[model samples]
Target: MSESVAGREAGSGIPARRLWLATTLILLIFVLLLAAYLLLRKPTEVTVPAPVAAVPAPDPAFATRVRQLEELNRSLEAEIARLGRDPSPLACPPGTARRAEARPPQTPAIA
Candidate 1:
């Protein structure tokens, strides 16, 4: 019984030593594979776009049209202001005048 116990204590250290060696070998293989992948990987490329040119000035004809529209807008605003002050109803058109004589009220006819 004493020899068997002694043999177990002696053999216990051999399995612990084998486990430590296996763990170290696995770690070394993982590190070598990671280093090889990083070394063989291709670098990314970046492209730069060209700068845009400055915008050209507006045309003279467009400037003249804009000024004419602004003047017309001012005149219409003045006419609206004059109408607001007077508050007069607009004149009826020539063809749609109301009749001068009032018609007598007609009672409903008997059936």
Candidate 2:
């Protein structure tokens, strides 16, 4: 193969030797930069949050109020059970039951 003075094959603009050298130089620069960054970069400080104790103690009056509300809810539920189906007619117009029309399941199309 005939070599040119610029260290390239005459017809081709890029030289194999120069291309290898340039790529090696670029890679070397990248490695050095990466090493420098790793060496000089500040270490991250990890902070552990102080442990918090859940609501030291619940108030006695608050506990009493909660119990009273629970008892009221139980009585209301019992009263509703005593009376079967919703006695009052639905707000909707007389003939139609207030519900959406049921549609058939659609078959999925094959890709």
lDDT of each: 0.92, 0.81
Question: Which pairs clash (backbone N, Cα, C closer than 3 Å) in model 2?
Answer: none
Runs in model 2 with CA error above 4 Å?
1-24, 28-50, 85-111
**Candidate 2: residue 98 lDDT (0-100):** 41
lDDT of 1 by residue, 8-100 (tens): 999999999999999999999999999999999998999989999998899999999999999999999999999988856766667767676
Return the top candidate by TM-score. 1
Question: 1-111, model 2: which lDDT tens digit per residue?
Answer: 344554554546547668999999999999999999999999999999999978768889999999999999999998898665556454556675544776655999999
User: Per-candidate TM vs. native?
Assistant: 0.39, 0.37
lDDT of 2 at 107: 100
Q: How far is candidate 2 from the true structure (C-alpha RMSD, Å)?
A: 17.1
